[model samples]
Target: MNIKITGTGSYIPNEIQKNEDFNNHQFFNENGSKIEYSNDVIINKFKKITGIEERRYASAQQNTSDLAFLSAQKAIDNANIDPETLDYIIVAHNFGDVDMNTSQADTVPSLAARVKHKLKIENPYCVAYDLLFGCPGWIEGVIHAQSFIKSNMAKRCLVIGAETLSRVVDKHDRDSMIYSDGAGASIIETTKDTGGIISTISASYTLDESNFLFFGKTYNKASNDEKKYIKMHGRKIYEFALNYVPKAMKACLDRTRFDISDVKKILIHQANEKMDEAIVNRFYGLYNEEVPEGIMPMSIQKLGNSSVATIPTLYDLILKQKIDNHQIHKGDILLFASVGAGMNINAFLYQF
Candidate 1:
């Protein structure tokens, strides 16, 4: 049985924060109260170096689950599937709502319940849950969903990739200057004779080696609005993206019983344009160094890095702008790859 994606949807913050915002004023750490800057000198310097004009920010009012729910609804509507027909829902993210009953421990049930109630999904029961491993979370959602359908545990599922990176971005640091908030969802409905994710490969290295780029908290159950922010070894992360992406991509291609030539197009986690270029360049023998435009960049210059949501958001963009032109034909192959906080790298081959 092939689990195929029938629809796609995404939601980004309504507000846009420009380069000037950082240059205009100084911000203090919510806990330490340490100031980041005294003036606009450094912000301009960053503008010249990174070429980022603006980025998105989620309001203090919105939480990760709220964004995930909206994206799921959009995907459901796009698929035109009766909300009642979905057997399960998976919301992927590093953050979750702050409720004792919100969602935790096991993601499969609590997440399903949250989406079922919030969307008013009627008739059929929905199994909701979360996947918290990090950026690899989204592709893992697809692999996990496929297994459920294979075992007859579910007939149809909605796999969501959601992120609120803006909530954790360290505005004080210029290394991670590009970051924003967004949510994306892809409809994965079960069918024995169709196209979908055909292969998925995951590999994790030592955490101590890759925890160089990460965010931590003052307390275990830290508030998102607290002094919560990201910390990173920028140089280290850039190196990881370059090193891990090709290995994972090749491993996925191998699992799917195909080569780079078998892939019509590739979708990668969009950490930055520089990193995207590095990976794309390596496939010169496979793709001729010619990655079709609008696919690789992920339009991240404006959206920044949306974490788990980045690849799905890029997929949505690909569908909206190019599906009708070159097209995802019957039996076509698609690939998804990512590396996140846990230092895990994952790749998947989709037939669509």
Candidate 2:
């Protein structure tokens, strides 16, 4: 039996946070020194590098799990499957459900359990849990689902990538501008179909790169309040991704014994536009070929980096014909890849 993604869905929050919104805000360096550049200058440079002009933010009433449930429901409806038949519910996220009023993350009940409860799937046999594998969490969840189906442990599974980065960001840090909130989900199951997952690869560089992305105090050193928010060494991550992501992608593709020209579209994590372009270029460089036009579809220009949600969300949008000039058809070969916080990297080859 082939493991396949039967249906997909995404939930992009309604509130839009524009770059101009940061004009009046104070920005600081990691060392607590005030940024010398004007807000306009900084924002312009940010736009050029990350390709993000605006991003979505969840409303006060919505948490990460709520967003996950909304997306999961849509996926179920899209697949036209009975919720009670699901054998597993896997939710991937870095921070748990973070309230709008507090910085604390709540995971007393796993996000998957919460989603299962919300979906009202009463089957006790439906195992539910959460996975935290950085931005690649969603893809990792899919890998796990595939393993379960192949091992005869499960027949149907729901995997979701959801995050409320806005609630976990340090407003004083400029990097916070790179983050947004959203969720994406998919229904994966055994199928007799022709195309599905082809090959997958995953790796972690924890020795020196462990702290490339981590939680730290605000950039404002004067503030005595002890609170930690998501932080990262942007330069370090950029270098790490460029050096390793391409190799991982090529390795995954090599395993499938497929030529590089066979890939139709690459759905990479929308972390940084420049970084992603570099990774793709390098991947092609490995084969001594020029990068093809439209080989990749990007949502970062409008979505920012929603961590685990980027790839699946992009997939949902393209499948629904929401992205202009980009479409996926049967027999098309697609490459999905991501690099994020754990200093982690992963890629999967899929045939649609």
Candidate 3:
């Protein structure tokens, strides 16, 4: 049975946060003390290094579940399937539904359950749950869906990755500028045809687990309100991406016996443009070939890093021909890869 992605959809907030938006603003360290840095130099470095000029931030009135609902409905409609027909709903998110004021995440209902209720999916048989695998959550959700379909446990599944990073990011921290909010979803079903998800794999290393990335409620003396913030070591992550990400991609391609030339697009996690470009170039180096231009489509310039939502959203945009200079044709091959907080890495090979 082929696990086919029948439809895809994504929703990004209308509120744009530009690079210049941080000018002359005070930033704080983890201890909450203010740190002085040239805003122009920081913005210029961000633009030149990450290629991110702007990103979207969800409004205070919106929640992660809200973003998920919109994208899920669009995907369900695109799939032309009744909501009741879905056998599973897998929502991948990091912080669940964190409020803008408190930065506290609520996980009791599970984001998947919240989406199910919002979508009016009444059937109890349609199992819905949340998966947390750092930024690879969405890809991991797709992997689980494939397993369910292969084992005859499910026929059709809706996989969604949604996040409101704006709610958790520390406004007083520079890293906050790189986080945003968005959601992306896909409806996958079992099909008799061959072209669909070809191969999937995931792995994790915990050596630097606590240092690389984390999210929690922490106090900032600069702000009157308490907030949960994302913290990370950029240099550490960059090194990890350059080393392990390419290895993971190679493992997936080798498992499927496909080469760099066989893939049409490489939709990777929109973390850093420089790191992503380096990883792809290094992957091609493994084959003693130069990296090809236009093979890796990037939306990080506009979307920033929406974590789990990045790859699926990019995939949807390309599939719908919404992204200029990028299009997916029938029989096109694609490779999706991501690395995140758990020190986890994953990859998938697919054919359109």
Candidate 4:
């Protein structure tokens, strides 16, 4: 069975938090107390590195499932498919519906199950489940759905990546500036069409677990309680992305027997602008060519790093012509890549 993405949708919270918002805030240590850092100094460093000017934060009452529902509904509508017709609903998220302020994680029925309920899909055959694959969760979920289609187990699948990172980020930490909340979704179905997912590759480097990113219980001054928050060694991740992501992309292209010059657009995870640019540049460099300026598009400037939701959201924007000069035509070849928390990296070659 051949798989094609029929439609895509995304939702960003209405609330906006600018980089300057962190200027005067005290940086937090492991004990959850504040260290001193001027907001201007930190903000400038963030701008130079991530190109993030601001990020969205979900409302206090909104949960990850809620965001997923919004994005999924738009995708379903765009696909013109009935909710009950979906064979699978895979929701990708690291932390479940965590409290926006408390940073408490909760996944009682699975985010996919909650999304199914909210969509009012009563079909017992419409299996729903949650996937946790670090920040590449959504991409991995898409790869999984393709397997089901290849085995003739499913006809239509809804893959949604939703996260309320604000709840999982310690505002007192500089990393919080890079984390944000949003949802993105896509409808993938078996199609006779020629342009879809052509080739893909995914792998992880986890020989020493301590080297990769992980969540640790930290002090949250806001809630005055110990909470699990995301923490990572910045240098390690930066080096890993620079070294391996380009290799991954080249491998995928080689497997697809497609030339990098033929790719029209590159939609990468909105993790960090500088890192993404470097990854694409290195990939093109392997062919001894200069990286084309417009071939790669970015949303990290405004969206920050939304983990799994980044790629789909960026894809949706491109599909809707929201990004300048970034339009997708039928038969246009595109590249999607991401590397994050799992110390994982993946790339997919797709034609639309």
Best by lDDT: 2
Q: For residues 1-352, what per-residue lDDT tens digits would candidate 4 score against the true structure?
A: 4699998999989989998888766676657666555667777987999999999989988989999999999999989998999999999998998875676778998999999999999999999999988888898889988888888899899999999988887666788899989999999999887878998899988885435687775545566556667888787888888889899989989997688788988888888888888888888999998887798888888888888899999999888889888888888989888887767888889999
Point out where model 4 deviates above 4 Å. Answer: 28-37, 209-211, 217-224
Candidate 1 regions with alpha-carbon error over 4 angstroms: 25-51, 98-112, 122-125, 217-226, 283-297, 322-331
Better-scoring candidate (lDDT), 2 or 3: 2
Candidate 3 residue-wise lDDT, 1-352, digit = tens: 6889998999999999998998856666667666656778767876888889999999988999999999999999998999999999999999989877767789889999999999998899999999999999999999999999989999999999999988877666777778889999999998877799989999988976546997644436745564447888788899988999998999999988677798889999998899999999998898898887799999999999999999999999987887899989888999999999888999999998
Cα RMSD of all models vs. native, in order, equals 5.0, 0.7, 1.7, 2.0
- Pairs that collide, model 3: none
User: Which of the two, 1 or 3, has more TM-score?
Assistant: 3
Cα TM-score per model: 0.82, 0.99, 0.96, 0.95
State candidate 2's TM-score: 0.99
Q: For candidate 3, report its TM-score.
A: 0.96
lDDT (0 to 1) per candidate: 0.70, 0.95, 0.89, 0.87
TM-score for predicted model 4 compared with the true structure: 0.95
- Against the true structure, whose TM-score is highest? 2
lDDT winner between candidates 1 and 2: 2
CA shift at 119, candidate 4, in angstroms?
0.5
Q: Cα deviation in Å at residue 213, candidate 1?
A: 3.4
Colliding pairs, model 4: 23-39, 331-352
Where does model 3 exceed 4 Å of error? 29-36, 216-226
